[model samples]
Target: MQRGKPLPQKEVAQRMEVSERWYRNLESNAGAPLTPEALIRLSTALALGPDERLALYRHVHANTKLGEPEPDGPEEARSALTHLLATHERYPAYIVDHAWNMLDCTDPMADWFPWVREPEANLLRWALTAPEAREQLTDWPRHAALYLAQLRFALVSSRDNRQLGALLDEVLADPECRRLWDEETKVVAYRQGHRFRLRLPHVSAREITVTSQVLLPAHRQELRYVLLLPESDPAPLPNRGERDPAQCRS
Candidate 1:
């Protein structure tokens, strides 16, 4: 209301189709009850930008439903990944929800990353809990910190998620993970590449550098693809000749 050449409250109230007294009440109390739709109108009338709009959502929807990035259904997310899986056949890739659960993956991803194929698997949970991870990731401790930091960031947007809460419970139970989280370091979401050293399914132990990235689908912000691209041609690549049918399925 008082940004620039202040517009009259009466006219503002009239434009919003609300009584001036009600508008005054809203202006006075920041905690006033507001539906999501009403907040949109209010944000726009105030000429709030995208960030301000989110701030409004964070405030108004604090105890109720989340504001934006409304997710596509899990099944729909799964169906969408089939196309993505086939497209990224040369690289290891898997899709995950905000909760970090693996919704789908390319065959090479399932072959190379054992955790992705496991049922009820979450990327964060797997990294922090899997015994194999300690040996697989050359930089386990640092990567763990980054992954946990990312989880903490996601929680701000999804305070009411039961599954995330349960996941938090399980994470807090782990002494090492809890300690790192307790430190409250500003690690944020994992976005960069990492060097991995692991014993393969059939091949000899291998060390490879792979970068991982998250891709949000056009229609759904929650459904994201975590892709691992090799930094360079891996030594003695999977199969010197034709790729294995079982390992590189489309």
Candidate 2:
């Protein structure tokens, strides 16, 4: 309902080159489910971002008890996050579940860490035990320590969730993880504007800012989105070179 314009029904019909009556029915949620074409038209008319557009489609036809079940599986959640991440090509974006598991990543992420293609990789594990973690992180100890602290916070906040709790135990069972967790230190509270600089396998160390947002009741698992952006534009970094940075640090 944009101001100074005809009703949404009329405007939508004109934009889609369809009958005003049909558009009215659709707008009123009385028409049949939207076809892909109709959905695209509506999305365009509304200037919807990928996530917003997907939400709109889901809203129109979703059958969940509530709108919370659209991303029920890892793949569905990945797809949703991927769509949003695709919107930012220059930046690296990723989605992590409540357990701090890295669920999905964008191309820029792969460019920074090629072995991210492995079946399932946890950012927490990599940050703590991977040698590449040490090499890539400009301030290895500090970043690793901060990451552990964040994971601890997430664990405490979601203690009642069996799955999340299990993940915490599994990660902590690793000797290195245990040592880090044993340290009775806590960092500042998690905030979105924090930034860090890290060196990648073949890439020169570059500064990157981290931004995070909570996707409420996300994907039935309280998943969150964490995006990484350049602190300032740096020359593009290499993807992979002589080292396999994915291996665990000895």
TM-score of each: 0.64, 0.55
In model 2, where is the ten-residue run with the lowest total lDDT? 241-250
Tell me the TM-score of model 1: 0.64
Best by lDDT: 1
User: How far out, in Å, is residue 112 in model 1?
Assistant: 1.4
Residue range 1-250, candidate 1, lDDT tens digits: 1245666778767767778887777878845556666787787777765544564565455566435664557567657766777888887788777788877777767767756656677888888877787767777787778777667656655677788888888887889889988775342543635444444534223576677776776655566777888776555645546555443221
Which ranges of candidate 2 are over 4 A from the true structure?
1-80, 173-176, 185-191, 205-221, 236-250
**Candidate lDDT (C-alpha), each:** 0.67, 0.62
**Highest TM-score scorer:** 1
Candidate 2 residue lDDT tens string, 22-45: 877876768655788888987787
